[model samples]
Target: MKTILIPVDFSDTNTNAIKYAADMGCDMPVKKIILLKSYYTSVYEQILPSPDFLLISADDIENERQKIEVQLKELMKKLKNRCHENIEIETVVSTEPIVRAIHNVVEDQHPDLMIVGGDMGHELSMIGEQIIEIAKSSPVKVLVIPPDCNYHKIEQALVPCDLEAVARLGVLKGLNTSHSWLNPKLMLLYVDPKKKHIGREAEFEASVKQLVNCYECKLHYSEDKNIVRGILNFATEQQVQLIIALPGKHSFFYNLTHSSITEALSLNARHPVLILK
Candidate 1:
């Protein structure tokens, strides 16, 4: 049984992600699906000289919260009806900030993965920022589905590993879990730093082979001057549909929260990228 956390704002994008997950669950094992909604009081609006705030009391907030819960219940019911198997659903209401709310939920629940929806362009820049924050801080893996993407059987998964750190069993466990649904063709890509000698490439290949032997997948290596450019180029050339990345010990998150590898992949890559922590 696997637990997946999905944060919803009642947007079509988020709902689409929900549908994708529900459909994917048809071939996989999902124990519980967590639906989270974060609500905040409009402090700025309260300061305004308006009648709207005056008419609204604590009771009004409670009533609205109750309404949202009812709507969520109906949505979950619809999801269950459409899914291939029965899945437990849990709903949460929070008044904390969005970033904080997500962190708190993950800490308390410790879900196996977190799924989110992305909207491109300037209108969604702030939403993108929040998603990036979640990706950086989340202790588990995070999957961001683009708005225009149709849920296809994920047949090929491109994993761009630099071979800089020892692969962890936990990370491999999560990857295998995704395999249950997509049964994807795993490509372990290693982009060697341009300064390194050719001999070092052989050593890296051996390490990757040993790490991935337990899992069923193919492996490939390439030398490139830039890490991000190498990954994007390979993904485009191979027509890869999804990319998976494991945040290394000295990952971009160490220096800045928003500059994580997953964030970079989201901003640049054409395919969806899954960030496994």
Candidate 2:
């Protein structure tokens, strides 16, 4: 809630995500936003035969760094203009690979959240392909913004949960701290492919009770052969603006393996998906 870290490739997908973060930063308790760009020489580029004169030099790398810095500055300026004057805007250019760059930034910034752009339909963009890895690996929570998704007030949020593993829901305990920024009515959904039910599990009910005390929340159940479809269908029907994915079997990476479900979410999702560790 205080700081957000966003890695950019300067693609349209990333641009939209930056804009979304800016809008949300203005509304939330964000104090700073860091834009990161990574630069690295690929193995192919390093090993391929080339004229000695044509080989990349220190000057070439310096020029490339300057160019990326300029781009980052431009984006930072745009965010500054869009967000509240009090919010700080910063940029980082790294000479490491994108994943490592992100890790380094996360270590250095300790951001409250990391936001990344994703396109799950057809072919995955480079950033899109890395979304799951980043979310799973990041110590901080991550928000995945679908391509072209604009900012909207999150009045309602749907959390597709695996009720059998209520312990994983502890990741959401932090939400209680951001109540004003989100202020969403929480819908905790348990989807059973075999049409099973939560039968008098005292511990499970206790966990749900604790969540109710944390936020204005309700527990719901659904029966569907396809879990991903069930979650998306419920989100759409309820008109929720955010979907929170907790770690473990019900995470995005688990569901993204199904191409059909991935495309379904890519095509139908209008809001961002928050991945909590």
Q: Give the best candidate by TM-score.
A: 2
Q: RMSD per prediction, one decimal?
A: 3.8, 3.0
Candidate 1 wrongly placed segments (more than 4 Å): 42-60, 122-127, 166-170, 177-183, 193-197, 222-226, 249-270
Tens-digit lDDT track of model 1 for 161-250: 645564642366556655354457778776776645366767766666677665567667767766677777888798877877667653
Q: Candidate 1: global Cα-lDDT?
A: 0.69
* Candidate 1: residue 260 Cα off by (Å): 8.1
Question: Which lDDT tens digits does candidate 2 get at residues 1-277?
Answer: 7889998888888888899998897778889999988888766665564676356666777899999998888888888999989999989888888888888998888887889887754454567666656766788878888886789888899988877677777767677565345668889888876655657456566788775566788888888877777887898899898998887775544555656535644764476888776
lDDT of each: 0.69, 0.78
Candidates in order, TM-scores: namely 0.79, 0.88
Name model 2 segments beyond 4 Å from true. Answer: 50-55, 121-125, 178-180, 198-206, 250-268
**Clashing pairs for predicted structure model 1, backbone only:** none
